[model samples]
Target: MNTRAGEAEAVDLQVQGRVAWRHAIRSLLAQPRGSIRMYSPDYADWGLGAPDVIAGLDAWAIGRSQTSVRMLGQRFEGLQRDDPRFVQWRIRFAHVIACHALPEECGGLQECLLLPEIGLLVIPSEKSRLAIYCSGARLHAAVHAFDQSWEHSTPMFPAHTLGL
Candidate 1:
């Protein structure tokens, strides 16, 4: 998934599993004024790392409010079924944290993380997970692309908790 052409440091993270993915996401997002964009089928594991990710955002928000995380996901079944952690995080950080449902036509919009500050992107590699450690200009383009898709997505987040 290191689609970037020149000098892209991409690391496959499939073997690294959820914990590693969680820690890397948590650590990179530690500093403030950074943006995170994630696209996953159901965001199953991202919820597992909610504490650290939210903590990072909390630290990042120490003096500012504009900083936040935007997620573009597909299925809401798993997220809505029994994941209370994700529910809680979504509620607590409702203002700075938001989730949107991207249409199926937006193919390849699944299982990726875009961290602007460190030029990082975590993507799937067919048989593995990928971590594009540093791809400065490339990440910006991806971020822009993700934002465009975000604009078209519907809000299925707290709405997941609607009838409860």
Candidate 2:
């Protein structure tokens, strides 16, 4: 990955295996300075909760008040149970990070991460443990699609749960 004045150059790469996917995610997380949008059925096999990914998010959002991380998922029960570290991180950055539940109507949404400014888009296939990295027109289209889904999503995964 090459950076021109802190902006990553558009990249096109095919990533295979869990390790490569994780690396691609980390690289994507490292490049964005404005906002990051993600859509996944459930972050079950994705390493969004891994130390490095969480750390990258931490680094990206620490002092950047303008930066935002928005995530959309069909359900979060699995994520809540499987990725405690990510839940904790989300709690800490609740102000900057938002998690939403994808509306039932949008059940067929694909798993992707969009970094608009840098034109980076990541489409991951959990079953095959493969991912595609692309930019240019596809990235814009993905951003539009993600925005549509996000607009219909409901806020979820609150920072705190109130129990009586």
Which candidate's lDDT is highest?
A: 2
Q: Which ten residues in a row have the lowest lDDT in candidate 1?
A: 7-16
**lDDT of all predictions:** 0.64, 0.75
Residue 113 in model 1: shift from native, Å?
2.3
TM-score of each: 0.70, 0.81
- Tens digit of lDDT per residue, candidate 2, span 27-122? 777546678888877777667787887877888878866428888888898999998988999888888988899977776556787775544344
Cα deviation at 160, candidate 2, in Å, is 1.2
Which runs in model 1 stand beyond 4 Å of their true positions?
1-19, 47-50, 62-67, 80-83, 159-164
Model 2: pairs clashing at backbone N, Cα or C within 3 Å = none
lDDT of 2 at 145: 82
